[model samples]
Target: MSRLIRGVGAVLLAGAVLGGCATHPNSEQALQQAGGDFQKVKEDANVLRFAPKDVIRAGESLARADRLSTYWGSGADVEHYAYLSRRYSAIAREHTEQGLNAERGARLELERQRLQLALRESKLSSVQQQGKWLEEQITSLATQTDRGLVMTLGDVLFDTGDAELKNSANRTVLKIVQFLQLNPKRVVRIEGYADNTGGEQENLRLSRDRAQSVADVLVDLGIDEKRIQVEGYGDQYPVEANASERGRAQNRRVEIVFSDAKGQLGAAR
Candidate 1:
């Protein structure tokens, strides 16, 4: 009976030793992982700046886990503290990323506003010089007609069959935007026309799309939509015969008709 009791005691002791052995490696691994995480957050400048308290807590917990790892039968406690350390480190990293993103967004917004202001000031500073040049250019590009002062945007400003205005049109568009800004009370009607090669309905749709595209750009550049009117004349009023490519090119055009100084516009065709 004594031998049986001794055998049972020895088996129980071995089982306990095996259980401790199983937990030991896991606890050591947890501690190493936690230490690595804590070290990374401690070294990161942004993490320190954004989450100093969380980083400090992570370091404290890692230290406690490291100390507990040296004691016997403290595997569970070591792993618990290590988990806490890793969680704190993860939280610190997350907070740092969020803070950095917010800072970046704010900086970008400030840069955008500053650039806009600089552009406005630059335009204002050169207004007199630009105004003289713009007047001469406008006089050359426009004519005094019964429809008021009409400026023509030729087919060269857009691709064949496309409603989009090309980058080459930037100079003329900018001049118009500046002109309208200078004459605040003056409004303009943008009329689009297409050659008669396509079907009538298709020409009408393309012409309208082209006109709307111009108006969209003007609005994007700070022009009020209410101050601008858009119209599509299609292939009805051709300035040149469409028998040749050159003449067709001439027929496909956009016309900007400016209102008088009193904001009175002529009749639309």
Candidate 2:
């Protein structure tokens, strides 16, 4: 009976040694992996900045695991502490990434708003410059006269004896339209004159048709018809004598007379 008991005791002791051997390698491996994780986080500046407390906790747990590894039959305790250390390191990295992402998002949103503001200011500046240029162009085209500010459209803008305005007049007409749009309170008088080439009644009819055609264009280009007055002087107010073709060309003209800033117009001739 005593011999059989001794044999069983030896077998049990060997089995215990084998179990310890298996657990030791696994615990050592766990401690090494945990140390690697902690070392990486400690070296990262952003991880320390955002998750200092988690980093400290990870270091403390790893130290406890290292101390337990030196003791005999403490494999399970070492593995538990090592696992805790690894978890703390992982938490530190997650927190750091989340913080960095939030900061990046805030910076991007601020930059977007700044760009939008700059774009709007640039557009406003461009519009003001355009308005100033148009004002200068209109001033250059007009002459201050007893008949108020008058801009002349020569006979070259129309066909011979025809009232239709040619496409060559597009630039001048667009300038007038833009000016009227800017000065909404101002009005205009479109006056037509003729040379003495035709009969009295025919000259009067043609002059009136030419004036009405110019007024129609102003209305089509978005100027209110109420702001325009049409008149025909026939051969009465010629700028030059009808002796030569050049003088006749100068006499045949349509003049746009602008009103004052308060919408007051000069008396019609």
Candidate 3:
């Protein structure tokens, strides 16, 4: 009975030792197979940089699974597998995070660009169709040299104390831009003017600033900068005297001057 018990005990010990030894000896190979091997993974990593949405997810999965298998061994294969799995996991994670961030950023940027493009297109269409008077002035720059047409500061463009064009003015500017685009041979002169309420120097500065403001708006709207000549006329050329606030308000404006063969034609600043 004692010998029989000892024999059974020895068999059980052997089985346990065999079981321990039997662990997937080739876990490295297993990992390689599961993870698509290192060379395959390197290629996958390279493609992940610019790969479309579907490919990135697939590679990440394969690399992750293979790496875990490599982690399970006790021999050199074990450390090697473990290293492979760890390294692959890190790379996979890094690629995923970077890719996600970049994708999100690109999506947001694309949406913004689309909105901007639409706004520009809308402004161009609406303004060009409606502003017949404005279009004529801008389009006939070279031919209508001496015909002086005056539009008050409050009537055509710009806002109070701001260089930026209001949406309404932007619409007008957009119309002018399209007109100029159609008539590339034409040239425009932008003049800035200010009321006599301020000192002469200040008035000149303000006038010039306002004129440049108009030119800037037009430029941003797609008109060529070289086609526009900017000038500032202080209170010296005001249509209204500096006696009343209303008169002063009328004087604070930009004029777009057109040089016809004969002389000045339309004033739109």
Candidate 4:
């Protein structure tokens, strides 16, 4: 009879311990809600790719909540852990959104830079075409020479022993003025030469006076004076021998040299 009584007492003690360890319904519900939220966020593509660490932390919080409910039953500690799990899930979602927004901003900036570069290229092409048209106009009036494009006015254009130009040379002067007006960026150099028939001093003075006469005409035609350079090369740099009248005639002339686009003139060959 004493053995039976002792066994009943042991059974009562075991039941009491089991009842103390059992979880309350409210604690179980809280754990389920936290776990569901974490799972839902973790499955999202952005969160999985960009916020993987945050999502992992949320899952760990949920596991901790579950352990607390199993060991301590319905308690404040379980609820606290459940709240932490839900907060971590929210943080993961927020980080994912921030990362996506940053990526979109970077793409927009790159597109803006591309458009600016294209616009600059278009403007440069237009400028190059305009320069080509100006070149064509110059070619019509001048002949290409070793030094650059040159326009020559023979001794017939000027009076003998005088620096004044003849009336017949008006057309040539007009064409030159029109070209200069069209291309304001171009620079002109007026060079004068004389035949060997004259004395050295007299020939040099005459050549210089003729070059100055042409320079004055250009300035009067609305071309800037700064764009013209004048020089006299008496009986020097002759194109033909002075032994014949024809050769001497060719040597006594004025040459207008046009520089390249950058205002650079090549040396005479």
Candidate 5:
């Protein structure tokens, strides 16, 4: 392809210039003699490419060419391969230098990529280990009976004056989501309780509203409404003494009670 040929020409031209730029002449005469040799060979009829014998000829030509190119602006008539001969030799010298530089760059780039891959693999392994440990913790929590979970929620789920689930109760909400999603056939109950600190009618209304709020959140989190029921346990079924702050806090909470209709998880047959 013409494109490929052009690309090759560009690379060769670059090598010649770069090679000459880096080379230092040991003696002025030696450099001039090499340049003179290239000048004489510029008239040669053969277009020799790079072979072992050709390399020797090219070297001889490059030295002379180098000398002639130095005198280009001195008003000498530009002969047809005079510039060619000089340029070609310079190109040959540049090729050697560029090849060495390219090899060194390739080696360093490969080393950098290897180190980067190693670091990424190490971090990925650590994250996978942490995920496994978290799964184990979830599994342990899943093995507990629903009543134990509800009892736990009673203490830590709400504050003394609030029916809102505490921040510490976030894990419970997540676990409930997981459980409901997994047991798609099971129905759940939301039972809200309030302490006797408020008036009887207000307490009942608050309990019902709070229970409805819990059910609303569950539904928003993808639980099916047909599988859930909400109820208010108003000032009744007290788990602890209403006189104490701790007991009142315990009483003011929501319970996610599982009532399996399909009995899928050993609750049926």
Candidate 6:
């Protein structure tokens, strides 16, 4: 009976030792896995830059797990600490990625704001330049009318009894070109008039021909043809009486009328 009791005691001791040996390898594997995870977290640039505190905590936990495993042998304490280290490492990596994404979003928003501001400044500069050019054109044209800025090219612009434009009239035409180029949205109406001295049919034909000549010149100068409207009003809407040579010259003229934003013009007096 004493021998059997001793034999049972020996078997129980061997079983206890084998269980400890198995636990030891599992604890070692957990610790190694934790260390590898922490190593990966440390190598990330975002983690280094943004999560230094979390990284330090993870490293300390892994070190504690290693020390406990070495001194106390594989146990619950070692496994708990290893798990904590891995969890902390994942947290650090996640926080680092979030921080990097936030920084990138902020930079993109700032860039968008800068581009918008630049575009506004450019538009302002363009508006000021257009205003300056328009003012100069209005002054040089020497037009005084209630019909939204009318410019008159006298009979001298065309040869006697002919629709052809004279070379000397190029200066006046170029001024119109400059104005049109600056204000692309602006539209104009060209009205040609003749004196009462000519026959009604002949005067109407000559008037239309002269107006078409002016429109062609503007189109040649890069102005859109669609923006220009032409008409012939024989011996009509004359600015001066056709009783004398000076008055007749003024009556036989082509008047260009600028319109409002909607291309609507006021009646010419």
Best by TM-score: 2
Flag regions of model 6 displaced more than 4 Å. 1-65, 68-98, 167-186, 195-198, 219-226, 235-252
Residue 205 CA error for candidate 4 (Å)?
Answer: 8.7
Q: Candidate 2's residue-wise lDDT over 1-269, tens digit each?
A: 99999998876566455543344889888998999999999999999999999999999999998887766588898899999999999999999999999999999999999999999999978876887798788779989999889999985776557778778878999999988887788999999887788888887888888889989998999999999999988878888888988888777778999998789999998
- Looking at model 3, the pairs that clash are 67-85, 70-81, 145-260, 254-269, 255-268, 255-269, 256-268, 256-269
Give the alpha carbon lDDT tens digit for every residue of 1-269 in model 6.
99999998876565455533344677777888999999999998889898998999999999888777754345677778889999999999899989999999999999999999999999989877976776577656756567787888886676557777788889888878877776667788988888877799999988888888999999988889999989898878777888887888778778888876567777644
Whole-model lDDT, candidate 1? 0.87
TM-score of 4: 0.49
Model 5 per-residue lDDT at 160: 47
Using all chains and alpha carbons, the TM-scores for the candidates as numbered come to 0.52, 0.60, 0.42, 0.49, 0.42, 0.58
lDDT of 5 by residue, 141-204 (tens): 5434644223134666655446566667667677676666655676766778888888888888
At residue 205, candidate 6 shows an lDDT of: 88
| TM-score: model 6 vs. ground truth | 0.58
Write the residue-wise lDDT of candidate 4 on 1-269 in tens digits.
99999998876565445432344556667777898989889789988988898898889888887777655444566777888998999999899999998999899889889989999999878766765665675587679988899988875776546677777777888777776766677788998888887788888888788888888988988889988988888778888998988888777778899887677766643
> 56, model 3: CA deviation in Å?
66
Query: On residues 77-191, what C-alpha lDDT tens digit does candidate 3 reach at each position?
Result: 4435445544564566566677778989999999999999999999988766655566565554323234443323343344434445456666556656776665566677777
Look at candidate 2 and tell me the lDDT of residue 27.
87
Model 3 quality (TM-score): 0.42
- Arranged by TM-score with the best first, the candidates are 2, 6, 1, 4, 5, 3
